[model samples]
Target: MISPRAPRADRRPVVRSHHGRSFTDDYEWLRDKSSPDVVAHLEAENEWTAHETSHLAPLADAIFDEIKSRTLETDLSVPVRKGDHWYFTRTVEGSSYGVFCRAPVASPDDWVPPAVDPAQTLPGEEVLLDANVEAEGHDFFSLGTFDVSPDGRSLLWGVDTEGDERYTLRIVDLASRAVSDVDVIPNTAAGAMFSPDGAFVFYCTVDDAWRPDTVWRHAVGSSSGADVTVFTEPDDRFWVGVGRTRSRKYIVVEVGSKITSEVHLLDAADPMGEFAVVWPRVEGVEYDVEHVVLAGEDRLLITHNDGAENFEVVDVAAADPRGLRDVVVPASTDTRIDGVDAFAGHVVVSYRRDALTRVGILPLSGGIAAGGVLRVGEIVGYGALTELEFDEPLFDVGVSSNPEWTQPTLRLGFTSFVTPSTVLSVDVATRETTVLKRMPVLGGYRSEDYAQARDWATAADGTRVPISLVWKPGAVDESAPAPTLLYGYGSYEASMDPSFSIARLSLLDRGILFAIAHVRGGGELGRHWYDDGKTLTKRNTFTDFVAVGEHLVASGRSRPDGLVAEGRSAGGLLVGAAVNLAPDLFAGVLAGVPFVDALTSILDPELPLTVIEWDEWGDPLHDPAVYDYMSSYSPYENVRSDVGYPPILAVTSLNDTRVLYVEPAKWVAKLREVGAPALLKIEMQAGHGGVSGRYDAWRERAFEYAWVIDTATRGARDDLESSAPVAPTLDA
Candidate 1:
């Protein structure tokens, strides 16, 4: 079928210069998203993409339906015991969102989550918030934070109606089931917390640039205009957040940037009190605090990177905040400390060791309900930490839902690429773990049918990069080639941990081998892994991804002819940069909300998050070195007419504040002008994350995966076409 002729974006050149380096952007005119011509061009591009992918509609639909069929439409989460209630969320059939509910606890000390199912509602079930009911008239919906008061009498929730990050804070009387008539606080950020007595709540608000710069304390039922500004960070580079410690004894006001952080503590018992800094902000120090009672002393479980890039845990007295004696010294270059959680009897240490997530339990001795320490040395007081063991070599596991400090069991979540997410309850004292539930996959499914493994590719600098792989047992043949999709994201020190995806099953069954490149710039291996991939070393991120794509071919895992590269947001930048560096290495490139115009965006400090991102991308505007370094790799500026670029799909949203839609819109326009097979699909009503709602999300994945399969297959039509799973009949 002949694809529709795409609309041509008029060349309206805009000269942009930074540190004596200048470039002309012909598609810069497309940045005016509000203009009718801009909308028409995007709409026309959507039409052309639809025409090009018309034959894959059945394929997309089949995958979407498969996801829906495999997923349990109605399900209930494990109830978490908080005060006198067991709080949980349930999803119903035909519901776009979840319903937050709670059931009365048999006893306050009962830590086990109720054996409840959405199909059979438990007695005395009280619904606190029905997101479906609340999201009745909105194009986008997100629950930034939802928390219950200390007495469990009221609920404070934050909601974002649009794709924008700002949320509206609301209060509801749990007993009366009536929304409070008080004026709601709008434009609040994440990490909102209630005071111990439940009279007041502290939340953060963004400045003009959409940075969460100011934190405020507001009386629950009072007008938002009467709220008091508790703290404000004058620096545009730092973002602020407020939250109560896990112990519920201290309220923390955290302010930090990419490289530095400072935390202030307030006694939760005192609502109108001043906060004291635990440690003065050091130039390059980043630390997180958690209140804990150790050996009869009030202390903060501090995880800081004083000199250790991977960070180490130290116990500092709450009274003598400046005293930082080490409890657990940093591991030599292996384990990267992610975070810590404090409980009455123990501290849960979360870190990444050996490139996979690891969780350990550090037990406290001689601790009581009230505070008092025996005055032992920091290192000798706490017993040796015990590591939680998981059989799978590659899996994502972490702690959560541990509301009560005195609770005996720790709630954990675990999932691997081929394993359905399982909720586990661990007995703190016994070290025994009990699997509460494995998410139900409705359609007939078996984990044994799938396979997952890890491989490594050596970089140009001799650094080995790990690649996580997943596929059906017979999905690929080493003797021949198979359609492959390589995904990577190497910015912000984020690790793309292995997790199960029902939608991914469709691709695996369709003769596709999916892999994730644990490239540099990510904290997978350690902090240095990320350090070597950002700013001046940013090229390592792109090159590492290309190296993995090349390794996958050389290792007989997959061939270059049928390889596709995929990434979203920062990952989009990864995929985009890789294509520019080696266009012929990939059969197609799927970039979602890509930061392709890295140099252009970094030069403008006024854009949302632009200034705050300097730590990650470097100061390109003022630093001539950074400017030249970034200009050499910025995807948009590097698009050349001479190269035979791959078929590219650039997906973006109009309302996104993080990575502007204009980046991909302009990237695709330039690619098309250069005679490359490229298309742009815009989600007009969505934000940074595409369309909300599980159904919409499923359909979106289906659209992208269908395209990935089609394009990857196009490169080697006869490689595995005979073995590919056929689209299911509509009636099936």
Candidate 2:
């Protein structure tokens, strides 16, 4: 066992922030001094990994081991449910696999894993379905999203090998208990949807650049010989990503760059042929095509965004693909379209206006404006509405009394920070709602126990960045300082919304305050927010995070030494940069599967994920300006050997395809050799996600919280002393 508090004299000296100058300014100055010729040469040398034994590798490994040993105990996989029963697959007693299922629970206390008999094999418990099962010497499995046929006679699933995202489609006959491989294009199987006619299957696949490209067709019961390439993308610059419409013959492909999108229609029979462009691209603006559905036999309902406003719903009549016309449902900027579900006679539209999401129904025959909007429920957060299928008997039983009796109702699920997920079935006719499922709260937890608030912090450049704070009622005050954890991810246009988590509740129950920094690089405030946090403006994310930390301490919400910063992936980069830029602001840091080597990772176009990420980070190799900008703050390059930084736990996975293990490995090693007290934990079997199963995920959370608690209360030095062994020499 390794201890945490051993003397570390060789730790690199910390680089101090210059007085009267921001870190970003200092970085700009550093970039200006690099010779143009040397910069060009460095840009040309895009090799991500040159030397393997840099001083960082060993220390990273040690830290990874400590975190892994402390945090991971159980395998945490997603739960799959059907009817009255729910099933979860996990590795039991080491390498052996099993499926655990039991009666459905209305609340958390009622939930329990089914008991298994060692001597007897139960139905649906034989071979566990996994995503990475084909990998060597590992019991890893890809639990691909699966769907049962309408008749419930077969199960269709997609599987991936190791980190190779390309999926292999497979089906198993329920009665025969035999698995059959489906004919799918090599590297072309993303989401699989069973056709309404049930004669063929439709699935999408990605191209070499990782952009969605084609949707293929495969006849039922046919092997490799019967598979057909249905729809192929028109060009490399534009990819075809498919969404099913109500009519089985029609599928919508959202095609365009990150800044814009157009919808296209393809004949289900000959999908590979040239598509009829249903919606043409709008110039000089960024738009997203969404909620595409068949409105009627000759009309389609589509949601689109034009540069000046949020998304709006529009109706386009089915015509020659080259001559489609806008029929109805005129666009408006005041109401932002959130969701849509189209049926034969009616279409349900959910939109957000003035912070409230309202649901409305429009009849194809009677224009959308004529059909008065019906209010459903106001929610702080809204997820895209989806339909859930129930057995014939169950569907019929709820027909009369169910508010959704106007038509076969579609269940819409919604949630918020305080509200657990709730499923509601809405009748397309009467617009009535029926509660189906509500996430059960544990005995001690209450929605009113904590309060959620949002505020803005001005960054060093005077940019207003949004921050969400959550703390127990009365726990935060001037006299009593609360331990705080500030989280953020400022890249990839991903939004960090408020949602309930049991693990998070565990922290709140312990009087810990949690805040999420909705920095500029995210989609929380839409496109403009994301634009400011990526590429040349990437440093804004870290600065915004630091500003939020300062606000929390300065506003009397939390103490400086009691604050801990946490983030994963790109956000992990946020965590690393903040700790390095302002170490005294945070007591501890948690960086998981971090993209710390930003410059080196982006420079190499040959790596699996690099080419696809150019749009987000900019092509540093071909552009000198980007190279200099990225290099200035690239976590690995900016590591200073002279500064004393806060203690950090850098978590990563050896098998992660997105952020390679070498990143954390190298970072930890370098930091340790320079005499910084850092820890690293590498999951041997997992990928980008630290763990695969639910139990394992919970244990990992427990370990992380334990570290945070120990650091905030018992003190980092005390915990380090108890865990680390005393050493005279500082050789990592």
Report, for every candidate in turn, its global Cα lDDT versus the true structure. Answer: 0.87, 0.59
lDDT by residue for model 1 (184-235), tens = 8888987687888999988999988889999898998799999999999999
The lDDT leader among the candidates is: 1
lDDT of 2 by residue, 1-732 (tens): 542232222232434232222222112111221456323322222121112113444433443344344322233323333333344444433332234322343443322233434334345443434432433354355544365554555667765545445667777776686787554334544577655455667777776556567766677788755677766765544556665564445656666655556776666555445656765786424433322334324555555665335555544446543344342334444454554656555555655432333455555344222333332222111212322232211011111111111234544665666666655656654556666545555454577877777677788888777777777775555366678889999897777766666666656756788888888787666556677888888888899999999988887777767888999999988988888888888888889899887776777665545755777887776777788788778787778787887777777765677787667655765676667767776665677766654445655666676666655544534555888977778775
TM-score of candidate 2 versus the correct structure, residues matched by position: 0.72
What's the lDDT for candidate 2?
0.59
